[model samples]
Target: MLNKTLVPQSVARKIQGMIQTGEFQSGDKIPSQREFSQQLGVSRASLREALLTLETLGLLETETGRGTFVVGGKPSSSSHMASWRYSDSYSAFDVFQTRIMLEGRITSLAAGRLAASQLDQMENLTQQMEECWARQDLLSNVEADLEFHAIIASSCSNAMLRSLYQMVREQISETQRHPIPITEPARMRASIAEHRRIIAALRAHDGLLAQREMENHILNTARCAGLAP
Candidate 1:
């Protein structure tokens, strides 16, 4: 049984390990939620969340009237991303476009204003993202990516812009996670390189360069999700 305090991301990692290690083969129908939850000693809600995370990472596929199945081989580019939960309020493309504008400005404002500790954490998180992706730990990879961006946003010198970012953070986060399922390996490597470029700009106190790097990073991510040209 898994630890009681484990979050869905941790549980998702466990299930992902099972698939990678052949305990759950490609195209195998996963056990039903009730049985799986009991087997893992996790609550149904937690198990469900874990399953959804794996599904979003293209490690699992759920079909109507059919149980979830492992996606054994390389995940297809056609595998769908998690449905935009904010559809009624905003489209995924809308959020991506806003991020390119808003985050770019925020990152520009953050230049030279971030604490050393914050910069160090961003560097660490960027490294963690590379490690997580190598291990196929997609949930952790995205979480690290989120924290890396959050550090830049929180460090922005403009309070109003920072406050506005906070207000729409949920949608921003969705856009961050939206591309993971379809992100190819080369693109992921490029993203890591983009992070390094942004960090270099920030460290050099080059606001314009930081903003450009941030915009390019978001634009590339949107392209990965097929939301941008």
Candidate 2:
């Protein structure tokens, strides 16, 4: 049974695990919300949230008249990304382009300013991202990725740049989560490697190299989301 205290993200991880282990095979229709809530020892509200999260991850699909089913084979990259919540204000492409410019400069400024503890935390979060992805915990993986980038932004020496990043934090976070559904495992591994390279550049106090690595990381992620060439 799932812990009563477990949030939607945690419950989503549990359901994702079941799918990964084939307990819920491809194309299998899952139980109803009432049944799932009872079985998982979670509230119906929590169950709904978890289901929505799984659907966004491309692990499940709900039909208009039928129940939800586990997705078969690889999820379609064309429609994998979750619907852009900020569409009313800006396009996903706009957000990604802005991120590349803003974060690249932030990383460069943070290179020599980050303390040892901040660096260590970034390293730990990167590791957590890998472990969470391996377990099919997409939400947690994205959370870890967010924190890893947040550390760099917070550590940047330029106060104005840091404030600008915080102002767009919501869009930045959405972009980070946007690519996960269609992200191949290989791309995830490459992203982890990119994080390591950025860390190395920061440790060496090489601002230019850190900026380059940061830009490349965002560009690669944008490619995964089909937002970039």
Best by TM-score: 1
lDDT of 1 by residue, 126-163 (tens): 99999988876677788899899999999899999999
The residue ranges of model 1 lying beyond 4 angstroms of the native Cα positions read 1-6, 73-82
- List lDDT for all candidates, in order: 0.85, 0.85
Candidate 2 C-alpha lDDT tens digits along 3-105 = 3325777788788878777798887999999998999998898889778767766777788899888884343332565567689999989999999999999
* TM-score for predicted model 2 compared with the true structure: 0.77
Give the per-residue Cα lDDT of candidate 1 at 77.
36
* Model 2 spans > 4 angstroms off: 1-6, 21-23, 31-49, 65-67, 72-79
Clashes of each: 0, 0
Alpha-carbon TM-score of each model against the true structure: 0.86, 0.77
Whole-model alpha-carbon lDDT for candidate 2? 0.85
